[model samples]
Target: MNTLSSYKHDYGPLPSEVSSAIKPIYEELSKEELLERCAGGFTQNNTESLNQLIWKITSKILPAGSKIVEIAAFVAAGTFNEGVLDLLLFMHGMDLMLARNSHEYA
Candidate 1:
């Protein structure tokens, strides 16, 4: 059997240290403070989804300017929260009218 001490000797630090070393951490999670923090059951689903949407709009393969990235984030967030038709609302708010074909597309 691999005991904690033996595992530490063979592999390096304990689980806590290993977890802390990685990005987007998975905690050792036994500590009271850590457990309490996680009691609410938070996860990165929304943030990750927003990032995926933004990347789809802006293209990670191509360099994008700050304004372009900002616009992409806005569009992604608006679409994610309210669907594609939200763009029509935004345009209407700005007094910009869309053609019949554009309305159909929306």
Candidate 2:
């Protein structure tokens, strides 16, 4: 049986008021727009790694403004999408030079 059917079987039918409260939410979730939004499904692996990378770029212990956070996110995204070498090259193109020793790590 479906999950909703199983739930009803185990716990009896939802009260009219409870069902009414849930109906709109269920309807909205089942709609094409929401379904399309959910089509990609959920995965936290990449996001967690990217967040770690961002925090590494801009330390979590320090207070940062939105612009700093934004820059860190962009840098993290570039590093994640490309590699350190490419990110360094891109920064070079934009006239942002890394220290001579830092290039060795890349």
lDDT per residue as tens, model 1, 1-106: 6785365454645576655677245435565787787779775578898999998999778789999999889888898999988888778878997888778988
Q: How many residue pairs clash in each candidate?
A: 0, 0
Clashing pairs in 2: none
In model 2, how many backbone clashes occur?
0
The TM-score values for the models, in the order shown, are: 0.57, 0.48
lDDT measured at residue 99 in model 1 versus the true structure, 0 to 100? 82
Best lDDT among the predictions, by candidate number: 2
Candidate 1 minimal-lDDT segment of 10 residues: 22-31
